[model samples]
Every structure is written in structure tokens, then in C-alpha cells.
Target: MPTISGAGFVVTTLNKILAIAGVAIVLGGVALGFRSVSAGGTVCGSAFQPAAGITPMSCDNALNGAGTLVTIVISAGVLCLIAAAAVKVVRDKVNA
Candidate 1:
């Protein structure tokens, strides 16, 4: 049987924490974006005006969907990286 290294354990734990934080940040960003869009408000609190004949939508309304999707993708990527790191740490520790 192989023994686990202290460094490996610590690294695995840190990776888990990072994964959780990444997910939280992504969720929060999406929620805020949706709220801003639904409220027809700008995330920056700036008032937007359309051209003389064109009607303008709020920046949030225009950008939130794509922004949320991008955030979610990034979060998923972080989660995958964390998971991979954790697995590598554990495998290394167990095989050492």
C-alpha cells in the first residue's frame, strides 16, 4: 500500500476550494446580469440614449445573455481544471 503525501493532500484541498469559488463567482455574475437585463437597466448605471430615429436597448439587456454564457463556460473550465488537478494529486500520492 502507498502512503499519501502531506503536500498532495494540501494541494487537493486547495483545488477543491478554488473550484467552489469559481462556481460561486459564475453564478453570482449570471444572476446579476439577468437581474440587470430584466430590469432594463445598465450594469454601469449609465443612462443610454438611442439615435434620433433608432431605439436603444439597455446594455445589460443586450449583453447579459452572451455574458452569462461566457461566464458559465469559464466556470465550467475552472471546475474541470480543478477536478483534474485533484485527481492528479491523489493519484500521485497513492502511487508514490
Candidate 2:
């Protein structure tokens, strides 16, 4: 059986953790968005709402769509995973 080095295992584990966190962040953001719409508000306060008419439905009306904070969060999560993978790749290349 091939044995993995401690450093190699640590890096792989870190990358996997980052990827998992990114996925969690994305899913949490989506859940939050749905909760916001259902509750007619958001935890982000007025920030995620429109410039005016900052009412209960503001978060729902704005963030429930694709072009809103939810999308940004999901994109960020995907980017985070991509960055982690890139880092792992770079590290592996350097080690090799």
C-alpha cells in the first residue's frame, strides 16, 4: 500500500475542508435567502433590500432572484472551492 506523507495529507485535508465550508456557505446562503423570503425579511437588514421601500418584502423581492445577494454568496462559495483546489494543485506541483 502506498503511504501518504503527513504534509501531503494535511494539505489534502485542508483543501477538502475548505471545499466543504464553501459548500456549506453556499447552501446556508440559499437557505437564508429562502427564509428571508418566507419571513418577509432578512438577517442582512436593509442592505439586501432596495434603495427605497425597505419593507418586509424587500429582501424577498430582491434576494430571492438570481441577480442578488444569494447569487453572490453562492458564487463566492464556488470561488472559494476553486481557490482551494488551485492552491492544492499549486502545492502539489511545488512539492513534485
Candidate 3:
């Protein structure tokens, strides 16, 4: 069996970390999105419109912000996963 050494070991470790982090981040984003939708719906009614006396547009802006944040988090997680895969491919090609 071939053994990983030096930079190869570091790369392998980093790849594993990245993959795990990506999965975690993706899950977190999904959770956050669900929470936001549910909470926003409750607070702003079915259509995300605030009640008559509440501050105008605040709820809408918050919901939009949450959506943007979720998108960014999920995109970052996917990029991390892709980077990890790319690293593995490159490392294998180099070793081969």
C-alpha cells in the first residue's frame, strides 16, 4: 500500500477538512433558510407583509437579507466541496 508523506499528507488532510466543512456549511444554510421562511411567514403574515402598525419594509428587507445570506453560504459550501474534489484529482494525477 502506498503511504502519504509530506505535502501529500497535508493535501489529503486539507481535502478531508474541506469536504466535512462543506457538508456542515451546506446543512447550516439549509437550516437557516427554513428558519427564516417560517419565522418570516409568522411575523409578516402569509405574504410577508407586516401588520398595519409595524415599521414599513423592515420585515421584507430582513427576509431578503436572510435569503441572500443563505445563498452565499450555500454557494460557498459548494465551492469548498468542488475545491476539495479538484485538489484530490490534481494530487492523484501528480502521484500517478
Candidate 4:
């Protein structure tokens, strides 16, 4: 049985954390894109002539909501990346 050293274990754990953060960022991007497209396709206006990609009822609300969601998601993604990097630094210092 090969026993992992302290530095090796710490590095492996850090890599896993970074990988999870990467996945979160990718998923967040995909969600943002999907919501934007879905919101654009919805109707938000009343009897007035809808603009391009605007619907009658759901356009404004959906777009606004999606925008908010995108903001939150992007912020979370950034935080995740920062957290991953910070954790890696912490792990390295502790292992060193």
C-alpha cells in the first residue's frame, strides 16, 4: 500500500477544490446563457408592438430576473475561484 505524504495529500485536496470551483463556474455560465436566451424569447409588452425578441408578458420580468440571477451567479463563480486559489495557498503554506 502506497501511503501518501503530507504535501502530496494537501496538493491533491487543493486540486479537487479547484476542480469543483471550475465546475461551478462552467455551470454558472451555462445557466446565465440559458436564462438570457429564454428571457429574450419571452413576451413582456402589452398591446404595443413588441421589439425584437420581446414577447407580451414575460419579457421584462423574465429578463430582469435573469439579469439578477446572472449577476449573483457570476459573483458566486468569482468567489469560488478566489476561494479555491486561497485554499491552495493555505494548503501549501501549511504543508511547507
Candidate 5:
């Protein structure tokens, strides 16, 4: 059986951990988006409703900001997953 050096093992573990965290973050972001839409709809009425002074300014801002935040969080999670994958490829090549 081949043995990995301590540092290599640590790096591999960290990469796996990062991948797990990325997945968790992505799921959390998705949940947040769903919750925001449901809660926002309940509070602000249907989005299909006319926008002429029907929805409060605060509700509009909150909904918009929530969307932006979800985008940012999901993007970050994707980046993390990509980074972990890249690292694994590089590590494999180096060990090969």
C-alpha cells in the first residue's frame, strides 16, 4: 500500500472539506432563495400584481437585495467547488 506524506494527507483532507463546505453553501443559498420568495410573496403579495404603489418600497428593496445576496453566495460556492477540483487534478498529476 502506498502511503501519503502527512502534509499531502492534510492537503487532501482540506480539499475534501472545502468541497463539502461548497456543497453546503450552495444548498443553503438555494434554501435562502426559496424562503425569500415564499416569505416575500406572503408579505408583499404576488409579484404578478401591479407595481404601481401596491408594493412597499422596503419590500421591493428587501426582495431585490435577497436575490443579489443569493447570487453572490451561490457563485462563491461554485468557485470553491471549482478550486477544489482544480487542486485535486494538480495533486494527482504531481503524485503521478
Candidate 6:
């Protein structure tokens, strides 16, 4: 029988919260991006072309959005793994 310590529990909980927050932020950003695209709003346009009636977006803009989402998901997953690892470590330590 192992007893969990206060510090370990708190750290694990905080890490889980941070992971959730990161996921939420990523989802929110993606939703905003979809809204922008649907509304014909350019996020990273070259010069905001309204005369030619053609919005110009560099490959970088698409890359940025994808990269951001990927980064967020990775960060969230890492944080969750860290939290799980911390819980395991604490349990092992307490048991030992």
C-alpha cells in the first residue's frame, strides 16, 4: 500500500490542467482560423489585396497554422505524459 504525497499530487494535477489548457487553446485557435477562412479574412496576407479581389497568402501562412496546431497538440500530449509519469514515479517512491 502506497500513500501519495501532497507535492506529487499537486504537480500531477497542475500538469494535467496545463495539458488541458494547451488543448483548449489549440482548439480555439483552429476554430478562429476556420472562422477567418470562412469570412474571407486573411491571416498572413502579403499586402491585403482588395483591388484585384484575390487574397494572397504565402505558403508560410498555411505552414504557420499547421505548425501551431501541431506544436500545441505535441505540447499537450507531452504534458499529459509527464503528468502520468509523475504519478507513477510518486507511487513507486511512496511504495518503496
Q: Which prediction has more favorable TM-score, 1 or 4?
A: 4
Model 3 CA lDDT for position 69: 79
Ranking by lDDT: 3, 5, 2, 4, 1, 6
lDDT of 6 by residue, 1-96 (tens): 755588867766765676676567556555544432212343442211122343445344554555566566656656666666676677568657
TM-score of 6: 0.42
Number of colliding residue pairs in each model: 0, 0, 0, 7, 0, 0
Off by over 4 Å in 2: 37-68
Which wins on TM-score, candidate 1 or candidate 6?
1
The 10 consecutive residues of candidate 5 with the worst lDDT sum are: 44-53
Candidate 1 per-residue C-alpha lDDT over 71-96 given as tens digits, one digit per residue, 9 for 90 to 100? 66667757766775777677667666
What TM-score would you give candidate 4 relative to the actual structure?
0.55
TM-score of each: 0.43, 0.56, 0.77, 0.55, 0.77, 0.42
**Candidate 3 local distance difference test against the native:** 0.75
**Alpha-carbon RMSD, each predicted model:** 7.4, 6.5, 4.8, 6.4, 4.4, 7.0
lDDT of 5 by residue, 50-93 (tens): 23444466477656767777888889899889988988998999
True-structure lDDT of candidate 6: 0.53
Best by lDDT: 3
**lDDT of every model, 2 decimals:** 0.55, 0.66, 0.75, 0.63, 0.73, 0.53
Q: What residue pairs clash in candidate 6, if any at all?
A: none
- Scored against the true structure, residue 81 in model 6 reaches a CA lDDT of 60
Report the Cα lDDT for residue 68, model 2: 67
